[model samples]
Each structure stands twice: as C-alpha cells, then as structure tokens.
Target: MQKKNNYHFETRAIHEGETGDGWSGATLPPIFQSAAHYHESAESLSKTFAGETQDHIYMRLSNPTNRFLEQKLAALESGAGAVATGSGMAAINNACMTLLRSGDEFVASRSLFMSSYTLFTTIFKKYGIRVRLVDPLNLDDIEQAINEKTRFVYMETITNPGMEIADIKQIAQISHTKGIPLMIDNTLASPWLCRPIELGADIVLHSTTKYLSGHGGALGGVVVDAGNFDWTRERFSDFAPFVEQRGRLAFLHRLFKEIHVNFGTTPAPLHSYLTAIGLNTLGLRMERHMENAIRVADFLKDQPKVEWVNFPGFEDHGCHEMAKTQFCNKGFGAMLTFGLKDQAACFKFIDHLDMILNIANLGDCKTLIIHPYSSQYISFSPALKNKLADPQLLRFSLGVEHAEDICNDVAQALEAI
Candidate 1:
C-alpha cells in the first residue's frame, strides 16, 4: 500500500486503514468477523486455491480486518508487506520457519523475551535449526557467531528487561557484507520509538500485543518486510524449493503467500480491529509513557534502598548515548528494570501499588509491574537462569499515568520494605 503525503505519523495511525466499504460509511474500519468466504462457482474456488485470484478462502488464511492491519503496519514500519499471526511467539516461529530449515542456523541476542528465548533454544533447535545466543551489543560477538550455515542475525532492537541496546546500523552492515539478512524483533522499541528497517534491517517483527496496541487487551503479532534485501542474490539455496522450477515467486514472495497460508497461524479479525484502535493513539500514549519512564527511572536511581536501575534513558546506564541517537526524544521506551533491597521488598511494593496492574504483562495504558524472577523467567534452568534472570530484578512497565502518583505508590511500598 502506498503511503500518501501530508499525513503525519499520528494522522496516519488514525486514518490509514479505514475504507468506505459497502456497509455504512463508518469512520473506523469495521471488524470483518468471518470464517469462510463463498465462491461463485467451482471454477472460482479453483482459481482462489491455485493462487490465480487474491481473495480470502478461510479465516485461517486471511481476514479483512487483519489484512487492513497488516497493510497499515507495513507502511508504518517502512516495509513492502506484512503478515499477522496468532501471537508474538507465532510471529517469531513463522519468521524462523520461513527462513531456517534443518541444518540452517541463526544468531540471536541472549537477552530476549523469556518466552522467545525458550522458543528458539527448545523448539526451533528441536527442528534441527540451531540458534547461537550471543551478546548483540558486541558486534565482534555477532560476527564471530556467524558461519556458512547462518541464514540471519536476529535480536531485539532494545534488549528485553535488561534494556541493552543494539547498534542496528553496524549489525546491518555486517549482515549485508556477509550476504545474510538482519532480522530484528522490534517489540521493545515499537515503530513510534525506532524503525530498524531504516537502519538497514531486512525484516522487522513485532509482538503488537505490546506497545503498538498500547493496551493489554489484544493479542497479535506482525512480520514486516523491508523490501531492501535482494533475494535474487542467491546465498540461500532454500529459496530453490520455493522457486517451483519457474522464476515466479522469489524468496519472500513465496513465503508470504504460500508458507503463511499452509502453516495456518493467521490472526483473527476482531483482534486486528482492537489492535488498530490501540495503534491510533500510539504516538500520544508513547510520549506519556516515555515521560513517565524517565521520571520513574530518575526516582529509582536516587533511592538508596534501590540497589540499581537500568534504563537506556539514564545517562549513567549502559547504551544511553546510543539510545539517544536511535530513539527520538521518546527516552528509550517505558520499560525499566531495577534491583530492590530484597525479595520481601519486591512483594511489598507490588502489593502496595493501588493504581498499577501487577500482572505478568507490559505496555498497557495503566502501569504494570512484575517480579521477573518469579514470573516470566521462572522456568529457566539454573544455567539458563544465570543468563536470563537477575534475582533482585524488578521490572516496571511505566504507563501514561501521572508520574507523581506512580512515585507515591513506589514510595509507600518502599517504606513497607
């Protein structure tokens, strides 16, 4: 879809996907809650199934509302196209499945979403796809990890929970020089905060259920193609199977059209509508979220009781300057991690928070807090635990709420500590 001129980010967010469908001219895109589409005749059905026509055959293949979201998000991420999936893990799995096969490999940052890290190490590895976990902040480590079998380099734009930032431009250059794609999971730094595609990333993936939705209500994910990588440059022989003996659909073309449908992890229409509603206010909400985060980080940094706080926005923290260059005055996103006095203090603070949700989720309009050790990373093995979790860590997803109120809640909770 072509992005029209004069429509700023915020404007595009609100108006990009709305269409004048046959129903009443609704200002918002209507939820196309459908399971299967009817065909006029058997001939038409054959055409649809044979890829001769582009129309929804089943909800598992495509849905109107999801298609609208895919188009809008593709434009937002500065990509050629996008595909939505059931959840963030589904999106990651789809990308991995499309790129890597048995004996193929990929490099990923060790600091990743706990669930995603598990998926890569446990599930993808089980399929003979090897994942080499490295510190993405070190360009040398990334380069060393890549070998002949490596298909791509994957990492989160902003490391999850740890808040470590990656030098995307440098990584992109390294990957491109080696004739490989640089795939980044951009959930932590949403499009509002950073666009990895512009920095030469080949593909950008998102768990839209997070900051993009700006709410915890919806569940969905997206994989956007930057359209920058030249698939014709043939380093990957896996593209051979997709070619079908004809020069028809190249690498990504076949993946998006065929593999996506065959896998059948398509996102639902209602979820897409909710995600659209959340995206419209993304810029505004992120602004407040960033502001609140800076305040919270500053507050925690000064607390003697607080052992340490890690936020890319804070100058003392690692990667603060890099974050300043990457994230436009958005102050390095709303997530910040801190070490409290003890486990007892962690529970006390969580229990005292009257306004914030103490759920295992993040990026909601309301502030959300979690003790990562007991919640998200609980399943990690002793060895993996050393790599994934910090015992004293308390992760906070600062929301758009008043900074003073948030601080007061933390203050009362700390007093109990």
Candidate 2:
C-alpha cells in the first residue's frame, strides 16, 4: 500500500504502506524471514554497514516485514517515522533509554499500567533515573514536578483499569514550555479512536499486541515520531549528533542507532506480518468494540450486585467531556472497570463466566476479564493499591461479539454471584 493520496482512515488502514508484490502480486505483505541479506560485492556490504546506503544489515536492526508494519503504523498515527519493538515494555524502555541518562528525571501520569510503573520505579530507578508520578488531570501537579533534570512528560491516552482521560494538548503545551516532548501511550485508544500526534503529542507509543493487532496472538510494540518537536535544544543536548545528521528524524534515528539496536528489541518478522494483517480490519473491529462496550457499561450501571461502574463513555464519568473533545465524540474505548461487593465477589463473578475468558490480556476478539488487584497491581503497597486499584474492581475488555450475548454473560455471572 503506497500512500498515494490523502485517504480516509478506513481506506488507509487497508491500503497504506503495502506495495503489492512485483513477482506474485500478493495484496498482503509477505513475511521476509531471512536472518541476513547477501550483497553481491564486499564493497556494497561495507557501504551498507557504514550507513552509506539503505539495506538490511541484520534481523536485529530491521526487516522488510517489520519495515512494512512500521510504515503502516506511522501513517495511521500521522507520524513521520516509526520503529517496531519486541514488546510494549521494549518500546517504553527504548524510549526511556534513548532520552534519559544518569541523574536525569521524567514526569509521568500516576495512573499507568502496572508493568510501566514497575519499569520506572524499579528498573529505571536502579540506573539513577528519577520518575515523578503526578495526577494526569492536574496541570499544577505536573508543572510543579518539572525541573531542570526533567527530560520529558509521559501519560496514557486512556489509563489502564482506571479509564481516566488526560488532556494531551494541554500537557503537550506544558512540556513545550519547558522544551521537552510529550510521549503518549496510546495502546488503549488505538488510532481508530484517537491520534495523539494530531492532538499535539510529539511521540506516540503503542502495544500492538492489543487493539492494533486486534487479536491476542502477536506480541509487538511500536514508537512513532510525530516530527513536530524540535530536538535541537539545550535540554536535549544528547540528541545533538542525531539532530545534526537527521534533522526532523533525530529522535527516531537515535532510537534506532543508540538504544533499540543495542537493546535488541527488534520484533520478529512473523509477528509483524500478523500485526499488519490484523490492522486491516481495525476500523471495523473498533466500531463493534465500542458499541458492545457501551451496552455492557450501561447494563452494569443498573445492576444490583455492581458497586460502581467507571466507563468514560458514561455522562457522569469525570473525564467524559474531555474524552469526547479529544476523541472527537468517537465511541469510548472497549475497556472498563467496575466494582463488585468484594474481592471474593469479584473472583466469583469471573469464575462463573462461561463466555468471557478470565485472562490478563485485553483487546481480543473474545471478551476478556481480569482481577487487576490480584494480577497487575499485586506488588503495590496497600496505600498505593488503594490509590490505584480497587479491591472489588474487575476490568473488562469487551469484544466485538453481539452486545446482548455479552450482557447476558455478565447477567448470568452476576446472578451466580
């Protein structure tokens, strides 16, 4: 799919970044699974290795299948360039390693995926990098946390389990004032619901393992450079070499050459192929996911056994208006969290479900549910857990299945409880 014209998202999702096979005329991208490419002459190989020409040097650096996937993702997110990673954590770690050094710091939204929290507090902390956790909705807290050492600001488009929406445009402006970029974790919203780059994000990250792949099969991640932020600044002095060489592509160039290459976070070609195939129907799948999610959220709101419901689509949700404005009134995401009578009740409800799978993964073709308190947030202290996780909370990832069937499963499970 060559980006021939300015097409709609649905069309771009299917057509962009895919050039049909010259030999076989295959509509879909073929998996290029070779470990290394052979060059006709030693001089050509040397030139390729020296960065004098564009060629695949090794699987750890790049692959044709992966490049195809990157192009599609960048186009979808309205980014200048993108890099595929081994997993979601790899993407986050790659970005952090490229930007932050010893004694440097970064500000992040308090409501984050448990693994992300762990990565910052445990892994990054060991390297002498400081992370300040602040409320995404509180600009004052974000501004107060920033100092000379702050490298960038980070937040999720839709928080995990909590479903809170951040004001990306406002946060981007705040980050720009201090000459730092805003990085958004857009795994939940996907490009179908929101493009963070369009909303003023400088860089966008995603766990393609989730909604982008649309199936729970492939584990992959991507980092997109929006090409809007200027890296030639005193704060980002480390990027000077890349900025001098690549200009607007400095961030992505540094990401590939400095961090991702050494970290060996390159995704497998087969996984990239799967993700590309999954993305073709992303628009269709998200529509049904949102539709089913709203019905499920509404149904849970009126249930006697349900203690509380937190879905951004609901009018009473604190972030509903912000979500509407940012997402252009698109359907609220498929993920939601609701409270039960207690932890035991939550476990009972999950155990009684016949159709929805009890699993840790989300954004699957089949509906999935998980007890976040026991699974994702099990290591947090009680105080931190109280601030982040609900003891009775059950996070649900609604699939594209019929809304009535999904509601019936929940009703039966609640009745069993």
Candidate 3:
C-alpha cells in the first residue's frame, strides 16, 4: 500500500478497479463470460497475441472482469501489477514454479498452512526442489538458513492456525541481504491490517477466498509484484528475457505467460466479479471482525474449562509488540485458537456450538470452528502435528457478529464439556 499511498484505503478499494461496461456504462463491473474475444481484423488479434495490445485473446489468458479485480488487488497491495489464479494453491504453484528450478531451494516458515506445508515438503520435493523450513519467530535462524542455493525467502504475514506474526521489515532486510526477493502470504493479515510490500516485501500473495472476499463467497487467489526486485542479477538469469521485454513487470509477465496460462490456473469471470463486489466493504468488515475477535479472545482467556488462549492480540503473547507495530495497531487479527482438556473435549465443544460452523474453511462472515488436530492435519505424525501448534486446540475464525452473542455461544458450548 505504498505508491497508492495518496488515496484513502476505502476510496481505492471501491474505485481503483472499476472500469464501467463499454455499452451500458454500468457502475459495477460487467462479467465477460465469453470463451474468447473476436476481433474484426486479423491484425488486431495478431497484435494482442504478440503482446502489443492489452486485448483479451482468450478467457484463460485474460478477461475484462478479472482485470478489474486484479487492478484493485494490485492497488490494495500497492504492487506494480497482479495476476489472478484459480485457487490459493494454484497461486503458490505458479509463483514457486516461475522461479524455482530443479536444483534450487528456498526457505519458508515452519508454521505454514497445512496445504502449503505439504506442497513444499512433498510435491516440490518430488520435483527435486528442496525447501528448508524454519520457525517463524527465529530471526537469527532465518538469517543463517540462507545460502548460495537460496533463491528467495518465503513466509506468511500471520501464520494460519498458529496465528503467529513475524517481523516483516526485519525479514525483508534479511532476504535482501542475500540478494533474494521476499515473498509473503498476506491472506491472514489482509491489506486492511498490513501490507508487506510497503514494509519491504518484493512479492505478496492472497487467497481471495478468505478476508479479501470477506463474505467467503468466492474462491480465487492473486499474486502482487512490488516491482522493487532486481531480476537482472546473475542469480535470476532465467528472467533476463522477461526483464528486457516487460521491464519492472517481469515477474507478472512470466507468471501469466508461462505459468498461469499454460498451467491452466485461470479463475472464472463470475468469481472475479463477486470478489470485486465483496471487496468494497472490506474496511468496515475487518474492523468489526477485529473488535469481535478481541472480545471473544478475552472471554475465552477467563473460562475455567479452557486451558489457554493463543492470540497475538493479548499483551502476554510474545509477538504482541511486533504485531502491534506491523499492523499499525489496527487489531491483532480475527483468527485465534484456544485449548481444551484434550482433543475429545475440543470435538465435544465444537459439536455443541449453536452459531459457529464446523466447516474446514476460515475467514467467513459466519463464525467457523474446527478441531485442528483431528480434521486439518489428521494424517500428520504426532511429532510434526505438535511442532506446528497444540494438537488439542480449537481454531476460531470470528465473524462480524456481536461480541456478546459470540461469547454467549462459546459459554453454552463450554458448558457441554
């Protein structure tokens, strides 16, 4: 959120991506649901294929509606540009595939979301791309982990289930010292809370299915490039062609041209349109989400049956000061996990909830609850599961509902235990 720093956040969120319909001049973006765009002349179509014009050749390559969403996402993240993908996992695949070669290796956070952890350790490993995982809070260990084989440094702005906040500014410095770009998964913090690029990240990622959609009605992802990284360096020699042609937009160009299109991680125009609409109310929703979260976290901390509440919002948390500084004190976040006596108690409590859903998803307008140990990482070994976070904890993604109502539901659920 740097170059767009001149505009107020709320104003940009609603206005930045809006390119009205050509025929109707509609205020909202019109979904271009066609499979391909036809031009009157071959020269016109040829120019677009040659990358001379920004016309839509095919839906898989681009769409007018998706462009609007991409623009708003880039502006919200203060990036040079952004590219949309079919899903969050697709976004990660496109990004890592764009840079990592067979022999290359990268460093990532140990407390990653389960899918990301599996992708890094399993699929990428099968392809001969190794990942070195480290604790998010260990800055010294992170700095030491980098070496000649490291291509880039990656981490989540806020760890998903763990809800840990790492120092983005310091970590960015560390990555830059090794002449590697820093990639941040900003899905949890959302742009309303923090923008990693302005703090020093070169690339930012988001799962629009989460806070960006706010309503949890869309499933999409975006990759935003800061245009601040130097791809002309010898280490990034593969990007030489893109740097020469696309200049500062080299990463975005390679992403769309080589990875996203060929890999077929294209998002539907309807999802883009709905996400664009949902984005308009992000600022308001995030505030209410945060307020409700603090109220809920505080309530859980005092419960006799609850063993512990793990939320960075509280001052007792080790990362509290860093989260306060990083998020500019907006509020810690809307996600938290609290422990019960055991996993069985967690399941019993979840079964008794009246309003909160037991769905696997998070960041929904309707409050969601899940027992991480049994559901999210059920296949993981006991040691690895505990290493990430407490296996007995119940994760909560608080909604915009009233604080009193959310607390009351928790009270009733606790009584069942």
- Model 1 bad stretches (over 4 Å): 1-3, 18-20, 241-252
Residue-level lDDT tens digits of model 1 in 53-167: 8787888887778888998898888787788887887888888788888888899998888888888889887889899999988999999999989999998988878799999
Error of 3 at 343 (Å): 1.2
- Per-residue lDDT over 9-78 for candidate 2, one digit per residue giving the tens place of the 0 to 100 score: 9888998886744427777788888999889999999998888887887899888899999999999999
Best to worst by lDDT, what's the order? Answer: 2, 3, 1
Q: In order, what lDDT does every prediction score? A: 0.83, 0.92, 0.90
TM-score ranking from best candidate downward:
2, 3, 1
lDDT score of model 1?
0.83
Q: List the residue pairs that clash in candidate 1.
A: none
* Candidate topping lDDT: 2
Evaluation by lDDT, superior candidate among 1 and 3: 3
Least well predicted 10-residue stretch by lDDT in candidate 2: 18-27
